[model samples]
Target: MAKLYTQESPKQKNLQPKKESIDFILNYSKALSVINCKDKKFELLLN
Candidate 1:
């Protein structure tokens, strides 16, 4: 009689982002709001 063997693979891991990355996203959103307001003001002046 012969015995059969099976091979197994290791599981993958998920990495978490750092705090600085989250802060950068928040600051970027604030900058975009300022740019949008400036664009709107410029358009009003042109009219």
Candidate 2:
């Protein structure tokens, strides 16, 4: 009888993001909020 040889499947990667990535996103949103506030103020001045 002949034996069959099969390759093993690869491992799956982590689905969740790391702490650094979460922190970066949070900081980015905060910065965008500041920019949005400035824009609102500028629009109010022009109006």
Best by lDDT: 2
Provide the global lDDT of candidate 1 against the true structure.
Answer: 0.59
Residue 21: error of model 1 in Å?
Answer: 0.6
Model 1, 11-46: lDDT tens per residue? 667766888999888777655532256447322221
- For 12-47, candidate 2 gives per-residue lDDT tens digits of 776788899999888776555322564473222211
Error of 2 at 3 (Å): 9.7
The estimated TM-scores of all candidates read 0.38, 0.41
**Candidate 1, poorest ten consecutive residues by summed lDDT:** 38-47
Clash tally for model 2: 0
The list of candidate 1 runs beyond 4 A from truth reads 1-14, 34-47
Candidate 1, position 47, lDDT:
11
TM-score result, candidate 2: 0.41
Clashes of each: 0, 0
